[model samples]
Target: MISSAPVIILHGGAGYWEGKNLDSVNSALREASRRGFEEFRRGSSIEAVVEAISFMEDSGVFDAGKGSVKNSEGEVEMDAGIMDGKTLSAGSVVLVRTGSPIRKALEVMKKGKHVIIAERKGNSNTTFNSGKGGDTVGAVALDLEGRIVAGTSTGGISGKEPGRIGDSPIPGAGFYATERVGVSSTGIGEVILRVLPAKEVDTLVSMGILLDDALNSVVNKVSRMFGKGNIGMIGVSKYGDVSAHFNTKGMPRCYQNKEKIQCLVFDGDFS
Candidate 1:
């Protein structure tokens, strides 16, 4: 039988939005927490975490769903990915709009045959372009049933040229999950593309590094690979160990839960 403990993780993205309204950020945290705990209470699988986060991704409140960033040409492009740890199944979508790209990625994983990559198109209704304007967010969750899933959604890089798709919708970069570990990320898309922080972290854990140390290594590597940009991630091990890390001046927000829930915001000054 599976353990009664469930875990959920969330990220708000990485950037220089220091003076932005704190209330809005708090509200987003509340929303994320609500969805996360609801899934736990229902004894749902990791899929429920994806469904709950998809609501946030589609809410236009944070930066993953409706208010995501725009490219250099002022058009919105999106990316998303999902992975199921138990089955090693994964799916990803890029450069489309309409339905949630993360959801589409999960569908692809479930279908288990095709690799779905949304091509860049002028029309913004494709699954890849649905949540431009910084509306993109990423998630990783493990349910009481011991199922794990990871997902990410993003509106491309800020000021990016039209048709420029980042790694968030790509597996291994923005999100990754396995029976041994779970991962999700947020930060500069271009940087994320190069380092593939989420998967790298998982690899470290597999190599016998402790979960917290593994996460730190990935965060430090990201900082070394891409200078000055913020990157944050959360991970949970098969042993129920939880860890999170960030390399920027400030990481907006991150949360986790096993028995009780906790929310963290790392702003500049470490106070």
Candidate 2:
């Protein structure tokens, strides 16, 4: 039988977070990790990821769900994705106006017909931040059954055009899961979509690389391809090992298990 020990990792996003805002981001990351682990203890990896993401969304501490940034037209259009490691089943939604974009993604997974749903038309405009915004939220967990699962949610880039989709709603780009590993990513949606960061890490793990090493390798690749401070990722291997990596100046993140929880505002290697 698998051990009761559970592992969970979560990220608020990657960007220029500092000072007082860093404190709020840290608090939210810690709470999210704690909540996810709680659900993991209940033996549901899926629920753990969902609950953790929902908490972050509701916290209004990150650019997702309730506090999602407005688009060019001053409207909030969110994207989210969820994946199950055991079955490789996945679901995603884009341009959602609901308060729970992550919940909608979960529903898509449960429904199991389509892998994605996207809004059809363009709306109005606003000037949030455009290309410089680094905003996405995600979680990965390993449950007692040894299954790994991952979920990601985002408000899309600041000032993004209405109906524009980002990596958050793309499986293998923002999130990926398999019997071997699970991954979730945050950063520039365009860069992430180009590299499919999550799946790249899993591919390395499948080739016998350690979870941390795989993550580091992917971070290095992104740094070379898109420059530093461009992407961040969190993951869990089926063996309950957890990994988090980013090329950004800061990424609010946390990892937890029965033994203890570790939360940090920036990756040590990045400093």
Candidate 3:
């Protein structure tokens, strides 16, 4: 039987942070940590973690969900993805206006589709309306039952043209997951789309590289291709090992635990 220890991970949207208040951001990080821990304690699967994180993402206070960035046209376009490691199944939606793209993506995954991108123009459905501000957020969970799942969501690039879409909601870009490894990222959408960093990291893991090393290799490659700057990711391996890395000035705070919750924030120089 699989062990009963549950693990949950989350990310605030990824972007350039120059003048933002560190204390306030830390508080938000703590809150997300609390929610994640609580869900884990409640016997909730990674699905619950994704739903709770979506609450954080939807709260206009962060750069995702309702408060997501506006395109050059001043409109929001969103993207998201979800994967079930146990089943090796995944789903994604892109350029959508839904509130919780992550959950919608999970629904699609349960329906047996490997990928499901939300159409810009399609028959009106409430699922497509869940992502309000085009913000993207992602989540991954590993329950004591040994089932793993991953998800990603985003608001499209700031100042992008009306139809411009990045890789946040793409399966291989913003996030990737499998029973063996899990990956999630935040940064330049174009660069992510071009290289499919998340899946690349998974491939590295499949090739026997440790999760942290795989993440570093992928981030380094993207940095070189897109110019070294603020690209970052948070990932956990199948063994419940966690690591965070970035190629730019700094990445935001994140926390993890199977015992008690802890939040780690980096506001200083990248090292």
Candidate 4:
């Protein structure tokens, strides 16, 4: 019997983290993992993933939602995506200006009619920031029922062209999930978009690849193609295994299992 014990993993982003104040980043991941696991314990992976990401979106610690960077025109725009492994159902939103881009993504998923939606912006009375510190935020979860779900939310790179959408809202590019596994990606959206790291991991895992090896292979493949510092991923398998890999100097991340939760930043830097 598949143990009802749930597992979850998440990432802030892939970027130079050799030196930078990350107290807030670490705290956010820890809190997210704790809250996400609680939701997973009683609900579905979908709920847990959403609840976790929604917190980060409003945390003002990452390049999403409140912490979204401005475009060349100086306005906050964001993108988000969520996927259900059991039904292969997914939803995404792009170029939106709101305090809860993750919720908008969830709304699109529940809508069923459209898998993706775009917006010029929203009139949410929310404050914006320079988007200092983080890059993107994402999560992958395996529920007690063995179902998996993955989701990603991002504000894109700073000073990007207006209406420019990255991999965050694109299935297979930023996130993918199957009954067997779930994957979420962060870092250089353009580079990530080129290789579809999330889907690649799913394909490799389905083909008998170990979750850890598949995650590493994706990073190696991306590193070879685009060089290092361009990719990071988190994965959760139906059997409750989890993995995190990235080529950048740092990818703030954490994972929770039956044992415990560990949050990390620079290599060897554990909190």
Candidate 5:
């Protein structure tokens, strides 16, 4: 039995933000969810996903579009991705500076032949040597029209090497959606890229696996496969089943549906 209204889920990031209070992070997640649900009620899954991510990006509390962390050279190199389930269309942008990367991802999905832009030459040599700032923000929403959309934005890791590209702007790596499911992810860009955890979750769910079972099983497998690196994700099925899992200290997250609005900093399984 599904609720009458739509459902939206958001994640501030997957790793720890040193010295920051959970209350403040929880507030940002709550505000983001509330704002995004407004758009969902207006019947636009696309707008809902963007609006939700925009709130977190503007909050400056998360490492996303505006307040993103700087690279080893102290420059901001951002990545973002978005996917619309109904149309099976997606977009992404990398090494971007200015405005919302999520918005640019949408434009890319609509206009470009390529899935991603500006191919970086090599992987960040410091992927495993990161110190703070691995946060990425994202949202998944199932709109009133039964459309599911997913989007993610990130500033990359703090002190990362310049030209270091992560999973955030990769379609299946950081975000994915289909008529049945939508997924968004955060954590160590290197591991997430290797695992493509978001797309894996959607793939499992499409195989008729239960949403929670699919997410938990895949996340655990990814953690085992990677051996090291934080990872967290949020997913929503078209029927409004929602779940989130993080293999880290905490993941600032929030969820809103017809029944309630809940926000929390998860240090445990919050599915």
Candidate 6:
């Protein structure tokens, strides 16, 4: 059965190896999910998404914010996005040099005048002490009032071209939300851009496809075209159906679908 209460899910990235001493990774994921859900109780879905992504960006354990990987020019560029399911409104920033990319994304969303913005200058921040492997951070949540939201943050693919932007800042590509569902994706930005996985999942779910089936089909489709180790996604429905699926070896997450990195929120169970 679908849940009507507040709920949230998050991901650190789509790659990992077994027995890699993921203590830091697991701790950060748990903290983000727990804190994000608390934000939901106090505010709404969008707030929860923002709070969680922000934390991950700062945690330095992933490829976003403080720990964002360096591009080919040995520069750090970042991307972030947010979407409101209740209104289909969005905001995003690309090639940002600031560490607070999530806040910038929120600013764009709040302006309601533009869907995307770009940046090329302004470099501030050093890598976090624990920041390491994970390449992106994403979240999806359903609030107590039925609002669903999705958001993502990334430091861009390591060794990418200096000014290149990925799916992270593209509305339907990296993140998407509608009245029925909210989605956030992490993977090879270029491939994700072509498939627009987030939007695709929203379309399928709206067409009466069950959540699991919809996610499964998308993963299968991506696998057929791009092979594995390319994508990971997390989502929440208005009625509180939560899911995480990835085509990569694994993604740091809080749900068990064959394998999961962590499960700290909602009592480690999904309704």
Query: lDDT of each structure?
Result: 0.68, 0.82, 0.65, 0.86, 0.81, 0.80
Better of 1 and 3 by lDDT: 1
Predicted candidate 3 versus true structure: per-residue lDDT over 1-271, tens digit per residue: 1112476666665555556665665566567666766776666556555765577665554556565676786566666777777777788766666556666776777787447766565332332223333224556667777676677677766677876767666677777778886777777777777888888888999999987788889888887877876467777677777666777555554555655555444543212
- Cα displacement (angstroms), candidate 5, residue 33, comes to 0.7
- List the pairs of residues colliding in candidate 6: 60-131, 63-134
TM-score top scorer: 4
For model 5, the superposed segments whose C-alpha errors exceed 4 Å read 1-4, 17-19, 119-134, 268-271
When 2 and 5 are scored with TM-score, the better candidate is: 2
TM-score list, all predictions:
0.86, 0.91, 0.84, 0.95, 0.89, 0.91
Give candidate 5's error at residue 146 in angstroms. Answer: 0.9
Give candidate 6 regions above 4 Å deviation: 1-4, 125-131, 255-271
Better of 2 and 4 by TM-score: 4
Q: On a 0 to 100 scale, what is the lDDT of residue 71 in model 4? A: 84
Q: Which has the better lDDT: candidate 2, or candidate 6? A: 2
What clash count goes with each model? Answer: 27, 7, 17, 0, 0, 2
Itemize residue pairs with steric clashes in candidate 5.
none
- Over the stretch 179-248, how does candidate 1's per-residue lDDT look in tens digits? 8788888887778878888888888888998878898888887777676666877677776666667775
Worst 10 residues of 4 by lDDT: 1-10
lDDT of 6 by residue, 1-271 (tens): 2444577788888765456557888888888877787785579888888988898888888899987888787778889999998988899998888668988999999999999999858765555433355778999888778898889999988788888989988988899999988888988988999999999998999999877677778988999999988888888776677787787766777632112224632112343
Q: Which stretches of candidate 4 lie over 4 Å from their true place?
A: 1-4, 122-124, 268-271
Return whichever of 1 and 5 wins on lDDT.
5
